[model samples]
Target: MLKIQNLHKSYSTPQGPLPVLQGIDLNVARGSSLALMGESGSGKSTLLHLIAGLDQADSGSIQVAGQDLGQLSESQLAGWRRSGIGLIFQQFNLISSLSVADNLAFQARLAGRHDRHWQAELTQRLGLTQLLERYPEQLSGGQQQRVALGRALAARPALVLADEPTGSLDEASSNEVLQLLLELLDEQATTLLMVTHSPRVAARLQRRVTLSNGRLAPADGL
Candidate 1:
């Protein structure tokens, strides 16, 4: 559902342009799960941003679900993002003022595709039913993450881009969240590309790709 060709992204440093991604090529088929593994500053998150159209690449092309992201205007990209891509961030990114239920349905409502039945199912599956009335600060880290996941999947997005989804949780919480994430994706047939530092998490995916110096390595056994 996603393809990147010779993608290059660089930042202008005081000295010169510092490259974060160099000639990166990747393809993720529909309804597949893939893990991107890399160390700190390895551009894993940057790659995710590029794929999600949150940031523009300096060169090359990104095609997601048959749409060339490079060809879309900013307004078009924003609309596509709301309708096409589901994003989960390490920070949870929940609005403090919004209740859990509101936050969960926020994006789906914005996309004008809110499905009450789907949202109800997601709430129960993600263990968020009881906390729907609570705000983000009222829940624990794991609970907040569950709400975030529920929000992302509420609209039945074609692709999900998660960056360090479990990085902020404890061991037990991480395991629980990861399992739920996989089960939810499987049940919905959602395509996922996750950037994670955990080998155990990466191993659960259909494929594991490592990034070193902004280039992708072959999918090897974790």
Candidate 2:
């Protein structure tokens, strides 16, 4: 469902061009999950951003669900991102002004795929029924993360891209949230590409790849 080839990216620093990703190639099948592992500054997050079309690569190609992302115009990319991809980040990124219910339904509504029944089910599954009226500042980190997960999945997008999703949670909370995420993804048959540093967390996915020095390799030795 996702493919990347010879991907290269760099950033302009005061000194020179700082390379982030170097000739990276990857393929993830439909309905499968892949974990991306790496150390700090290893380009894991950069790769995810490139795949999500939030940033452009200096070279190479990214194709998702048969559409070449490089070919899409800015407006088209925005529309595709709204309807075809669900993204969860390390930070909650919830709208502090909106209530939990509104945050959860925000993406789905934007995608024009809002389903009252489905959202209601997500609320219950995420243990958010009672917190619907609460705002982000009023919720705990774990609770806020759950709300973010609910928002991402409420739209039932074809692909889910998560970057350090459990980074801010404790071990127990992380395990709980990861399990729930996998269960929900399975039910929806959505493909997953998650960037995480924890081996324990990566082990839960169908496959794992490690990024080192901006290159991809099997996670076995990682």
Candidate 3:
């Protein structure tokens, strides 16, 4: 569902250009999960941002779900960001003012893909049925992460992009959330591309790749 070839991205700095991703090449099959591992400042997040259409690549092609992201206009990319991909961040970026129910439905509603029945099932399966009316602050870290997961998958997006999803959680909570996420993905037909630094987390995925020195280290980059 995703293909990257010779992808390159750089940033403007006082020290001229600082390259983040250099000649990255990756391919992910549909309905499969991949773990992106790298050290701090290894450009893992930079590559993800490019794939998410939140940032543009300096040179290279990124084709996702058969659409060339580089060829998309800003408005088209914005629309794609809304419907084509599901994003789960480490911080769980839930709307502070919205209830759990509203937060789960927010992106799905915006994408015109909201399904009440599906959400009903999701909440039950996610153990979020009793917390529908609760606000973000009312929930624990695990609960909030579950809500974030639900919100991301509610739309049945073509691809799920998660950046350090379990980074903030304790090991046990992270394991629980990761297992829940994998089970949900198994039940659905979407693809997952997750960025995680933990080997335990990476091992749970179908495939793993690591970035080193602005490039995919061939040893583990697959």
Candidate 4:
């Protein structure tokens, strides 16, 4: 559902122009899951940002669900992202003042595709039924993460972009959350592109790709 061709991104550091992503070429099939694995500062998050339209690439073409992101204006991109992409960040990024229910429905409402039944089911499945009226601070880390996951998936987006989703959790909680996410994705048939540093997490995905020195490293089996 997503394709990147000759992608390049760089920044002007004191040392000179430093490349964060160099000629990254990737293709993610529809309804499939891909794990983006790399070290610190290896451009995993940068690439995700570009894919989500949060940041523009210095060069190259990015196509998600047959739409070329490079061609969209800023406002167009914003609308496209809101309607087409579900983003899950390492930090929950929940609104401090909003209740869990409101947070879950925020993006779906913004996209004008909020489905009451589906949202209720999501809340129930994420174990958030009774906690709907609570604020972010009132929930545990795992619960907050589940709420974040719900918020992202509530829109039924074509593509899901997750960056270090389990980065802040302990091993047990991370494993639980990852398994839950995978199961949810399978049930929803959602296409996922997740950036994670853990080998176990990557192994759970259908395919894995790593970034090295601003470029895609050779796939383990390909």
TM-scores for every predicted model: 0.98, 0.98, 0.97, 0.97
> What overall lDDT, based on C-alpha atoms, would model 1 receive against the true structure?
0.93
The CA root-mean-square deviation of candidate 1, after full C-alpha superposition on the true structure, stands at 1.1
Candidate 2 residues lying further than 4 Å off, grouped into runs, are: none
Q: In model 4, which runs have C-alpha deviations exceeding 4 angstroms?
A: none
In model 3, the clashing pairs are none
How many residue pairs in model 4 have overlapping backbones? 0
The lDDT of each candidate is 0.93, 0.95, 0.93, 0.92
Per-residue alpha-carbon lDDT of model 3 for 1-222, expressed as tens digits? 999999989999998999888899999999999999989999989899999999999999999989999999999999999999999999999999999999999889989999999999989988999999999999999999999999999998989999999999999999999999999987887899999999899999989988998888633544
Q: What is candidate 2's lDDT per residue for 109-189, written digit by digit as tens?
A: 999999999999999999999999999999988999999999999999999999999999999999889999999999999
Candidate 3, which segments miss by more than 4 Å at Cα? 218-222
Candidate 1 weakest ten by summed lDDT = 213-222
Ranking by lDDT: 2, 3, 1, 4
Q: Write the per-residue lDDT of candidate 4 for residues 1-222, one digit (tens) a residue.
A: 899999999989999999999999999998899999889999999999999999988999999989999999999998998899999989999999999999999999999999999999999888899999999999999999999999999999989999989989988889888888888888888999999988888888999988999998744774
